[model samples]
Target: MKFKITHITTYLFDSEVFLEPHYLRFRPSQTSYVNVSELALTILPQPAGHKMVQDEDNNSVDFCWFEGMTSQLTIKAESVLETKPYNPFNFLIYPQNFNTLPFQYNVLQKKLLFSALEVVPISKVLSDYALSILQRSNFNTIPYLTNLTKQLHDDFSVEYRADGAPFIPDETFQLKRGSCRDLSWMLINVLRQQGLAARFVSGYYYFDMVKPAYELHAWVDVYLPGIGWFGLDPSHGILTGNTHFPIASSAHYEHTMPVSGGIRGSASSKLNTELIIEKL
Candidate 1:
């Protein structure tokens, strides 16, 4: 499936976010600008998941409070993709992001920055459970899984919201249900906890039946021993196939918010959100 996506995030700054220089993993070091691409990419708003000013090289930093972000994405199948079923062994598992950034919760708890998260779920335990799901000796491989990258299809559940409420892990554990981000995060953490590397994916999903062919969604991918990396949507209870177009992924979703960053100067600002995903 092919899609066009629009995402916007606004920041109400008690502070400012300045541009800085730092390293972006997948691009050339000289890359200071992002261009139009149908492929996946990552953009940083604040270095450690908080608002900060950054320089051109993406290195030097200035202290700041608010950051605002917006992103438009075009995701289409790449006929000449860099990764292959056989050669993507390295990409399937989690990349060593430890060097670039620390665990989301650990950094804040240490009081390293103004960054924060309360009731941060301990991820290791969850990642372990997810890996076990993939390695089930009796699990039968879905034949389509092997042909997915080449398939032209779509599979996603109907859109739903969480009542804008947050639940503790124990609640999710007992209920075994939640929103897309919840299930996606839960599955990935379960896999990571087990020593298996996993990452949370965020982007647009579409019901192939939709005329526009896209909508906002979240899911996960885990590394498998025999197959490089495979994706799964625990909410949908199946493996992810090529029909899904991934925009960006990180240890978690905060890294892939539709928009994040701050506008240095503006009249008194207020945040308002609007979203609509239609089949057509």
Candidate 2:
């Protein structure tokens, strides 16, 4: 199916700022089954503003604001393309084992290949809840994993906000909930703790009974050797499927962030962002 995707992000601040550095992952990626066209980012930088690819292999931006008087970072992205995603329910191609997958431990021990997970530390001790998410042997234990893989036309909540990092493994276990990226990253770390190879995913997803219309999102996909990487969203308690156009992934959310960079002068400034994602 062909999908027209449009994502816009606007930032507002309290007063005139010196620097407004930011990364722009607003650009739709050209993946195996997705194509990107008509992509651009406009920043209100004081002296000059430009964007660059943070990682070409995974498709992320290391954007920044050199010098600016304004206090806003606006990013707009749109594209026309078709998607041929792989389904996980009916096919049941491979079962997840996590016991033996590449980079199961010391996730960054390899070539230091950066991914969504690499940004976050997944090597820490595991909590009961995060560990339980991976310990499930019987797929039947997963509340909605089987059914929702194909259940579409349902409403979903698309949240857009940023903040300081949350307590890992500990807090996530009690709530069994978090932002989209948190859910994705938490699960990825959980799987890693149990010797299962997992990675972080960044993209967009429909909340619940809400519309699929969303800005940016995060999830996880674990390698099961035979079946390859299968996606799961512990937050929503569902498996990611065809409609989920993956932008990029890593061992942690920080690595898979849509944007990341440092500013020159704007150190302690309140950053406000308005994100509008529409499906046309």
- Number of the top-ranking candidate, with lDDT as the measure: 2
Candidate 1: worst-modelled 10 consecutive residues by lDDT = 25-34
lDDT of each: 0.39, 0.52
Error in Å for residue 44 of model 2:
2.8
lDDT of 2 by residue, 1-280 (tens): 5666666655565555555456666555565546554455555443265646657545666466565366555555665556666546543433333232222324443334233224334434444433343335333323323332222112223243466553474455445345666555555565454445567777765333364434566667765435555777654556776666677765655666665664444435555444444444
lDDT of 1 by residue, 1-280 (tens): 1233343323344434343322221211111121223333323343344333343323222233323432211111121122112222233223333212122323332342121121245544443443344344222233222222112112223235523332444445546556777656554544343333566666545454534433357776644434444666665555654444455565545665444433433434444333322321
Question: Which regions of candidate 2 fall more than 4 Å away from where they truly are?
Answer: 46-51, 54-57, 62-68, 89-162, 206-215, 226-228, 264-279
TM-score of model 2 vs. true structure: 0.68
